[model samples]
Target: MDLFQPSPSAHPGPELPELLPLGPDGIVVRFGRVVSPQLSAAVLAFEQAVQENLPDGVTEVAPSLSSVLVRFDPARGRRDQVLTALRKLLGGVDWLAETLPPASRIWHVPVCFGADQAPDLKTFCQLAGLSSEQAIAQITQTPLRVLAIGFAPGQPYLGYLPPAWDIPRRAALTPQVPAGALVAALRQLVLFNHASPTGWFQIGETAFRPFQRDRTVPFALKSGDSVQFHAIGSAEYSALKNRSDGLGGARYEAGA
Candidate 1:
């Protein structure tokens, strides 16, 4: 895990708990600072290791960008043991590009870039200091790895955007972005699979819903999946939304 260390003041301290009982049934073990790729990798890798070696009593283990939530089944063991086990394992694990958990799936997502449906599209190009085409070229230039899904159900913060593309969140959030809105901010791009408010640059649209209500594996994308966006226009997005003959036309299916 030494390779995951932040330089100088960037270090996020220890992976120790800052508070106990992150909840009544679970605990959150924190690691490093917020939003750093190094720390995020550590968090995910640690979660994977714990899941593989969990003692008999753990009911659930949920991992986020910088924390892991452990839920214990009282029927099996006590929370104390769970915490101790997590600590013992995480303390000894390695988290670096060389040790990443390989992806379970690779999905191709279709997205329509810079159209009226994406109201914030123009604004995003302006903020990035690039022409509309240039912005589209950059965004679709490579596949982004899924980091973690949070904030909204099935909403993923995908990233490792080029350093020059990083930007902070807007001062205010979007009033409400549509379910398929593609939002980008800082070094991450999130697929807004459901209607919600956000401040990330609304740059694209997708036909694949990342969040669904009545199905198994509702999220179309999972952590570690790779995604590339292909551009289309407003007309297609509208057709897809209308459930008309042209549904899915606006988005390109590049394959998973």
Candidate 2:
């Protein structure tokens, strides 16, 4: 027997999600208008469910900060049929109550937050009304969650800093921040996976490379993972930077 019978007209319940079509073969299931842990959890749960019990014709499922993007094989399934299947799947679960997907790890990343390593540290401290040591202490003391991966390949958006640390992006963009640059803004921190322009305040730099194209697993971190940043000195940073193995002296623990 089929796991689920397709309804002639799929109607979403009170907690119904908004289904927005993307191009011809994609659909975005938006859980809420804003980003939150609950929304992220819901999106990830729905993403996992879709990946595990994909209806006919779905090709890929990608989770975002607050939504899931499902791609379909147009030749194999009509849009309406896919939508019906997705609606049924969405209605089947209590999204808000869903737990985060497993295999989440805690990564201890070594960062050099000295003035030479972090060009914007002074500015960041000025804005946050903290001394350099205080700023570093505040950042390093907290373990941040991997909220979403975007902006660059393997670049993770980690966050939920205390309200006092909720700083805004710079008015102008820095020409470019190299890979492994630790930047922060709006209560979230982003470790740059590759050189890119950014408006976020560059607070530190890590030798750890999260994105290794040649490696079997290109991305070292995933959404729902925890990241704890620890301060390191120039000598250690240089030593780790010279190593060719490519993990950049970062350590990982299985459970978060």
Candidate 3:
């Protein structure tokens, strides 16, 4: 299908309403005013299709929360041409859930939340008017999906935290959290792969290194994978850590 044709620039429209250029090499296609999973899924479907087909003059097609950035050479096709291609793809896209790629990953990440392990767990409980156990229970009860991985390499933002779990990031940042730290905010839980400072409520720590440079698959997680963080204590994390290599993975089947 010619993803280069123009249509109405609205939801499900063939023509994108706005096209912003990234210098002379790239263009950002704005699908809507805000980031919605529906829009993200659409963007991803298009991205995957483009990756599989690969258009001429285009080098990269990346999908963010609600927009797609297309990189191409102006010498081969003007910015307009790129937009034409995008419009055609957007128009041709079929957003049925079936068209979306399977997540292909379900990871049971073990975590140690609260106290020294999670400095802000108590605070999150206080803000939510719940006790620590209730908070942990709430977190463990819900399964989260990898929303998008960015703002840092291999760093992922997972979401739709229950309303009771909603809270804003702190005004001040905490010291860098280690790789595998589980944090929550904005209805999202982020699993850190690299040590980076963050303000999201630190709820737990896991040995599951999300990013590993030596491995062929550097990032252990990807957007679309399902995750459930099981709570444990420092000693448990220690036992898991000590025998991690023996287990052969940062994570394994929960019961296994």
* Best model per lDDT: 2
For model 3, residues 140-240, the per-residue Cα lDDT tens digits are 87876676778877777776567776777899998888766788876678877778898887887777767667766777765666777788778888777
After superposing candidate 2 on the true structure, give the runs of residues whose Cα lies further than 4 Å from its correct spot: 1-13, 92-103
Model 1 spans > 4 angstroms off:
1-20, 94-99, 233-239, 242-256
Arrange candidates, best lDDT first: 2, 3, 1
The TM-score between candidate 2 and the true structure equals 0.84
User: TM-score, each model?
Assistant: 0.79, 0.84, 0.76
Candidate 2 per-residue C-alpha lDDT over 100-206 given as tens digits, one digit per residue, 9 for 90 to 100: 67636889989998777899989887888888888888789987877778877888888767676677788899999988889877778888878889998888999
Q: Write the per-residue lDDT of candidate 1 for residues 103-217, one digit (tens) a residue.
A: 5565655577745556776777677787777777877786677777888888787876767568778999778988777887787788776788887778888776666666464
- Winner by lDDT between candidate 2 and candidate 1: 2
Q: Which is the leading candidate under TM-score?
A: 2
Q: Which stretches of candidate 3 lie over 4 Å from their true place?
A: 1-17, 33-42, 73-79, 92-101, 242-256
User: lDDT values of the candidates?
Assistant: 0.67, 0.81, 0.68
Shift of residue 84 alpha carbon in model 1, Å: 2.5
